[model samples]
Target: MDLTLAQEAGGSSLLSLLPFLIILLLFVPLFLNGRKQRRQMQETQAMQSALEDGDVVITTSGLRGTIVDASYEDTIDLEIADGVVTTWLRVAIREKVAPDTTSEDDSADSSGSTGTSESKPTIH
Candidate 1:
């Protein structure tokens, strides 16, 4: 009888704490995701503020261009083509283009003749 009473007491205590545990589980992920999004927004703002002329960048709209003038506080002129410049909001710029770093050896291996007997099948 005493063991059954103890078990009931323990079960009630766990039930009392269940709501708090559920709330904690639900809020933890939301708080962590909000923090991560805030950090990403700060990083994007810093990148936008650091833009300068001659930097190659892509916009959020997927337009690729080179910065021709960034003298304005909130706008920049981008040269998308030869002698064609367009103004865009600084916030529209997504990220600076990274330089291609393909090594000469890799290019030569792909393009050079490998003294193999197997020839590429020609399509008529």
Candidate 2:
């Protein structure tokens, strides 16, 4: 008539917390996902803002280029390698490349054909 009352009180007290605990469990992932998404968006924005002229960049299409311009409207002009210029949306840039790094050695090829036929038959 004394110790039994304390045990019964403890058991009933824990029941009230069950629903709150379940709600917390369900919301945890959703909260974490939202925070992660927000961080990703901020990172994207920072990357976009850092774009500058002469900065080599890779587009989402796997195309590589140097950034000729970046606009607030979320678009940029890319100078692909040398002499190939193209316009792209800011979101299309997947990565940035250092401007000084280039595989095409300027000394090895001087005025070479850019994948286009320039041969003209000699008229005898």
Candidate 3:
């Protein structure tokens, strides 16, 4: 029953490695998720640093504004409303808001052809 004892030893070896394999499986996804998050953060930082005047953006807190000035080292002037400019940290800017791509005719058509037009005031 020397053969039986050898078979039992091999089974035990496999069982001993089971816990290590489970732990490895658990850590792999966490490692990959962290790497992905770090890469995204880097991309966000790059976007923030490259911001310029007139670029509309949204903040982390859901405030939408236009970039009035980006000359400061760590802060930016965000005009949230006409004559209502606010200063914010550059890092607070979440993402640049894309301009509406529809043409004026398409927009007018969608609005049911309102004869009146309202011009938005600039922050200056």
The candidate maximizing TM-score is: 3
lDDT of each: 0.90, 0.79, 0.91
Q: After best superposition, candidate 2 residue 123: deviation in angstroms?
A: 35
Q: Which 10-residue window of candidate 2 scores lowest in summed lDDT?
A: 99-108
Model 2 per-residue lDDT tens digits across residues 1-124: 8899999899888988899999999999999999999998889778877888878788878987777777657788988756777888888887776544455555434557577756658743
Candidate 1 global lDDT: 0.90
Q: For candidate 1, write residues 1-124 as lDDT tens digits.
A: 9999999999999999999999999999999999999999999999999999888899999999989999999999999989999999999998888645335556865876777665678743
Candidate 1 clash pair list: none
Q: Residue 112 error for model 1, in Å? A: 7.9
Instruction: For each of the candidates, give the backbone clash count.
Output: 0, 0, 0
Measured with C-alpha atoms, the lDDT of residue 15 in candidate 2 is 89
TM-score of each: 0.78, 0.64, 0.82
lDDT by residue (tens digit), candidate 3, 27-93: 9999999999999999999999999999989999999998999999999999998889999999999
RMSD values, in order shown: 5.8, 9.1, 5.2
Q: What is the lDDT of residue 111 in candidate 3?
A: 83
Model 1 ranges with Cα > 4 A deviation:
100-124
Off-target runs (Cα >4 Å) in candidate 3 are 101-124
